[model samples]
Target chain A: MSTIIDGLSLGSIYALIALGYTMVYGIAKMLNFAHGDIIMIGAYALFTMMNLTGSPIVAIITAIVVCTLLGIVIEKVAYKPLRGASPLAVLITAIGVSYLLQSVAQIIYGAKARPVTLFSLGTVKFGEVTLSLSALVTLIVCAVIMVGLTLFVKCTKIGRAMVAVSEDKAAAQLMGVNVNNIISITFAIGSCLAAFAAVFYLLQISATSPTLGSMPGIKAFTAAVIGGIGSIPGAMIGGILLGLIEKLCQSVTALSPYTTAIEFGILILILLVKPTGLLGRKRREKV
Target chain B: MSYMLETNNLGISFGGLKAVQDVNLKIEKNCLYGLIGPNGAGKTTLFNMLTGVYKPTTGSFSLDGENLTGLSQETINHKGIARTFQNIRLFNNMSVIRNVLVGLHNQPDFKCNPFVSMIHAKRHYENESNMRNRAKELLRIFDLEEERNNLACNLPYGKQRKLEIARALATNPKLLLLDEPAAGMNPQETAELMDTIRFIRDEFDLTVLLIEHDMSLVSGICDEITVLNFGTVLDHGSTRSVLANPEVIKAYLGD
Candidate 1:
């Protein structure tokens, strides 16, 4: 039961971050290289808010808003201009953005990790595992966002436009979708999701560092790729699978020290078994 | 009287190769117009320019007296021009019904409530029944209603072609462009496609411009034909006249 709870909790967080990766990839067909760093930025935002106002709610809100804007700006400045460029070029630019963000963060926030003191309002005991209230909140919040996002994508006009763009950009544009705007919107939403994930993460971990986004970002990315880069449900599945892999490795005999390695092994195995990921279909070419 | 569509000195080039150059043509509404040419005749190039894929480096195009130049395909599509590719491009992963729903994306957002909008219950379902009814009707026309629930990639080659046409028609365009719509079909499929084209033209009240290499196919269906060769219009007239023209024959048959 505790293992299940641990998997579900961590899985939810991974799912949130993975979604940002998946959504941006789906619409733009570009893997956002800076996405993990974007989460780090969110952590800094929360840090600043917590220091200045000392309110958790304000900190969370500021984090989401600031990260959201950062994401949109990143798209406008970095991703948008390279719209028609090769995927490799865009990828390199993403890496540049990630490093740039980290360096700038280090200059302002410094290299030292700060401990979060905002956990005074929380503790939840369920079964043998006493889940932190903040942790549960993080899990629920992510689920809510996912549910809302799924509805928006599946039902709305802009959502249809997004689907159309992903299906065929040229054709979608011919349908008057404002492709550039749609792409920007996708980035903004993805950034906001990552931002929320970052804040939730900081609340749970009670720590923030300039270079903190690296591991979470890599894990989320692995989740996205394992879920199928361009698939939403696949991201969710991938995140849960990744979380389970971590927990299972930690709990299993003698693999506790090799937790990260075991998780990576699962990702590699999934990639080798199905290049397109779990839910990704093998697209056929009409010859 | 306005020609339903016209191009004035239209030109496009890729790396100075000039795939299409200074081409002019016109079509009346509700006409089955044929654009015939041999390989590398730049027929598809001209279509690409008109559809806003490769923007024209020079000249202008108008549809129903509206300047179609400087328009993206979707904007032009919104202006009631819809098209199929020379090679089929379907939303391969999505089911056939969802594919058709995607076609009607621009049908104006109705029923704006958070619950329905969020869950897509009201907003998602709004006009869905009617859309499905229409989708069924289109499938029935193409004899594909039976396969409406299948993945587009799962369908047979002939049915895939039909699905493409049906999906495009779901957009309800005033002008329809068919690019080698029957390229990979058998004789029986070709004949059935001809009938389908005619049915669509009359049913949708559409003006069509087609690019086809099959003389029998084009001549069989088109009322007027324009032949292009080496990026220039070689001849334009009734299908019989264009087919009989020595220049069109030499360009096509090379003897």
Candidate 2:
């Protein structure tokens, strides 16, 4: 029971971050390799604002706003011009952006980890199971955001335009959708999710560092692929399943040390078995 | 009276190859214009230029006196032009209704905000219902109302073509461009598509430019016909005159 609770908290964070990967991939058809680094930036933003204001809400808002703007700027400057270029060129650019963020962080924050005091309202216990207040808050926040995201994609006009652009950019353009604006919005939404994920993650570990986003970012990407890279629900399901599996593995004494390797093995196996991921539709080219 | 659409010396090239060149056209309001040519005679290329898929290399065109040269495809579309592909390009994963809704992107924000939509707010609900109603009306015009919920890929080829036009029409365009819309249809479907095209032209009060290889379809419906050979207009006139022109016949058949 405790393991399930713990896994839920961790999975919520992964799910939040993985949404960024899935949405950008769905609309833009290019992986934002720098997406993971946005979480690190979000963490630092939170760290600085928390120290300045000593308020959780202010810090969270600052992190979200900073990441959202950063995402839009990166997309406009780096990715926009490469819209018609080959996918390989765009991919290399994404990786370049990732390394650039890391280098910038190194210059500013240095190599040492910074300690952060997490905001805690209170804790809730349900008969023999005691979970931290932060864990409960993370789960609730993730749930609201996920539901909100689904609604945004499914019910809104711009959201429908995103799906149309993903399907056929030229066709969507012919329909009068501003493809660039939709792409920028997709990045912004994904970055906002990343900002939230970073906050919950910092709460769990109580520290921030230049490299802090790497492991979680990679894991979230793995979660996205496991669920199906372009699928929103798949990200959530894949993340929770991955969290459960990791927790279960850790519970077993002999397998605990191999959890990372085991998770990666599962990713490789899924790729081999189903290249489209769980719910991803295989593209059918029309001649 | 001014032409609804006009082009002068409109052409494009790739390196030294003049893919299309030295073409002049004048289409009157609410006219159904047909462009026919042998494969590689640049019929689709002409459509590409007019639709702003490719900017003309050396000339210009206008719609309602507005120069369309050098505009992006979407900007041109916003200027009251809409088109479908030679090959169908429906949003295959989406429902027929959703595809039509996408076509209506420019309509006022019926209901949406990330936060409001997430909460299923009243305004959002009203906007979606309005959009759905609009999409349904378009589907009805194309006789696709019954399949509104089906995935686009699941539709038969004839229906898919109709759905594509339906989606295009949802943009509320003043001019409609159809590139070989009946390319794959059977004789019966083609006959029905002809009637449907004529009906929609009148019903929607739209100017239509179409590229078709089917002589019977073109001659039966087109108000004016233009024939192209080797990137230049070979002959253009009333359907009967152009079809009777030896140059058009010779262009279709080898020397």
Candidate 3:
């Protein structure tokens, strides 16, 4: 029970962050590979602001704002100019941006781990299982954001525009969609969500480092691909499944040493069984 | 006299191979114009130039007296000129109505707040539903209403072509450019499309320019026709006159 709850909490956060991946890919069809690093950047933003001001709320807001801006900048500088390039070019550029951010962060933050002071570790018990207040809060916040995101994509005009761009860029262009602006907005929103996910994860784990984003980022992308790369609901489901898998693997006495291996094994299994994903649909090229 | 669209000495060459050259045309307001020629007579290239896809080698194109030589395609589209490609390009994964809803999104008057857009904006909701209805109406008019919720990829080949035009009309352009409204359609489908084009023009109050090869549709529905051969205008006038011209006949059908 404890393992399930813990895995779910972490999985929820990964799912939230994976939305960033899936959403951006849904619109741009390019893997914003640097998206993982964006979460790291957000964590550091909170860390530096907290260190400077010692005010938790201020730190959170500052981190979110700065991360959002950084996301916009990354899109404008790194991704936007390379629009319409091959997936390989964009993917490599995303990796380059990830390295660039990691290096910049290491240089600035001194390459040491720091603890984030979330509102203290409190817990509530359900049946025999205990849930940390931070974990509970993370689940709640992620739920709210995911709900908002779902509605935004479903009910909003810009959201519809993003859908259109994803569907047929030329047709969207004919419809007067500023494809560039929409793509940039996609990155900004995805990055902002990644940052939010960083804060959520840090709240549960209470530590920060320049390289902290790497593992979580990979996990979230895996979740996204597992669920369905271009699907919103798929990301959520994939994330939960991945979290459960990770936890279930760790709980087994014989498999405890193979947690990472199990995570990878699931990915391999899913890919070999279904290339697109469990929920992923096939896409045909028109343009 | 003023024209809705004008291009002078407009031309483009693909590595010294002339794709379209010395092309000039004036689109008067609210006229349903047709550009017809053989399969490779640069009709698509000409459409590309007018819509700011390929830059002309040595000519100027203007929309509403605005110099469109350096403007981006988005800017040109924003200025109320929109186009569809010969290859049916719809957001394949997107729903049919959302594909059309994307047109109204080009205008960024909506507040960037996801909160407002998600809830409590009556105008946004109303306008959006209205837009959806409009798209539905278009699809229904084109006999695609039942497929509004389906992904664009599932549409039949002929319907996909019409959906592109419907999606294009969603942009609310003063001038609409259709690359080939009958690319993969049968003779019966092309005949129905001629009436559909006329209905779309009048209903939307749009000036239409189409690239087509179906001489029956062109001569029957086009107010005027321009023939291009080897990237140059071989003939231009009323459809009967141009089709009757020996130059057009020889270039298209051979001597």
Candidate 4:
């Protein structure tokens, strides 16, 4: 029971990150490889803001604003110009951006990992099952965000525009949708989610580093692929399942070191069985 | 007299290839105008230029006396020009109603802040319901109300074409461009479509420009016609005279 709770908490963080990945990929049709690095940048911003203001809420808000701006800038400067370029070229540029962000972080923060000051929300005990306050909070926040995002996409005009843009850019334009503005909005929302994920992620690990985002970033991406790359619910399911599996493996002493391998092995197996991922619909190209 | 759409010496060239050149067109308000041509006669290319899909290498065009040349496609759409592609390009994954709602997105009356939408505020709810009602009305007119919740890609071919027009109408366009709307329809469907086209022009008070290969449908509905051959206008006049022109017949049937 304790292990399951732990898994759920960890999975919630992965799900948050995966949501960003899936959304950008869905709307922009680009794998924003630097997305994980944005989480790192968010963590750094949070660390700096917390030190300056000594308030967790202020720090989180500042980090979100900063990361949102950064996401938009990165898109306008990097991705916008490459809109019609081949997918391979875009992928390479994304990789370049990831490295640039990491290098910039290293120049400012150095190579050492910095400990994050977590909010002392305290823990909860339900008989034999004990849940950390942060874990409980993470789960609630993740669920709320997921539901809110789903509703936003399903119910709102701007949300409908996003869906239309993703389906066909030219058609969306004819309907009076500014495709570039929509793409920027997608980046903003994805980066804002990354900032929130950074907070919970730091709370769980209690540490921050330039390279820290890379591991979790890759893991979250894996979760996205497992769930179906562009699906909202799929990301949640994949993240939680991955977290549970990892937690269960950690609970067994013998499988502790091999957990990463096992997770990837599962990813390979899932791909072989269902290349489009769990919730992904197969697209039929009209000839 | 001010025209609904006027292109003055409009043309575009790709390197040395003059795709569309020196095409001056005048379409009256509430007029049903037809653009008929052989394949590669640049009918679609002309439509593309009118909708701002391609920047004209020469000349200018205007909508209701407002110059719209060099503007972006979305801007042109916002200025009351909307179009459907030669190939049906509905938002395939979205529900039929949602496709119309997308066209309604830029309407100032339906605008709600993103934050308000997120919270499902009263303003957002009202705006949403209004847009939904409007979209439903459009779907109802197009006889697509029964399939309002179905994905657009799942709709039958003829219905899909109607939905595209419905979606375009949802934008509240003053000038509607239909590119070969009856391309794949049966005789019955094409006849029905012709009636729908005429009905919509009268009902919506819209000016329409369409490209078509179907002579019977074009002559059956279009009030005026322009025939193009080899990137230039061969004839422009009322439908009967234009269709009867020896030059137009030569363009269509060859020498």
Q: Which candidate's DockQ is highest?
A: 4
Candidate 1 ranges with C-alpha deviation above 4 Å: A118-121, A126-129, A155-161, A248-254, A283-286, B109-116, B119-124, B127-134
Residue range B75-186, candidate 4, lDDT tens digits:
9999999999899999998999999999999998887898888889999999989999999999988899999999998999999999999999999999999999999999
Clashes of each: 6, 0, 2, 0
Over A117-152, each residue of candidate 2 has an lDDT whose tens digit, in order, gives 757656778887877778778888899889878878
Candidate 3 chain B: minimum summed lDDT over ten consecutive residues — where? B107-116
Score residue A48 of candidate 2 by CA lDDT: 93
Please give, for residues B1-255, the per-residue lDDT of candidate 1 as tens digits. Answer: 888889999988789697888888889989999998889999888878877887899899998999989777777877878788887777776677667667766654332433455555644565556667877888889888888889887988888878878877877788888899889887888888889899999988999999987767897999998888899889998999889888878887889
Is 1 or 2 the stronger prediction by DockQ? 2
* Per-residue lDDT of candidate 3, residues A142-205 (tens digit): 8888888888888887787887777667656656778888887888788878878878878867
By lDDT, who's the top model here? 4
Q: Give residue A110's error in model 3 in angstroms.
A: 0.8
Which parts of model 3 are misplaced by more than 4 Å? A285-287, B107-115
The candidates' DockQ values read 0.42, 0.75, 0.71, 0.89
Task: State the lDDT of candidate 3 residue by residue for B1-30, as single tens digits.
Answer: 778888888988889798988888887887
Interface RMSD of each: 2.5, 1.5, 1.8, 0.7
Least lDDT summed over 10 consecutive residues: which range in candidate 2 chain B?
B107-116
Model 1 residue A52 CA deviation in Å: 3.8
TM-score of each: 0.91, 0.97, 0.94, 0.98
Error of 2 at B198 (Å): 1.5
For candidate 1, the TM-score of chain A alone relative to the native chain A: 0.95
At residue B50, candidate 4 shows an lDDT of 87
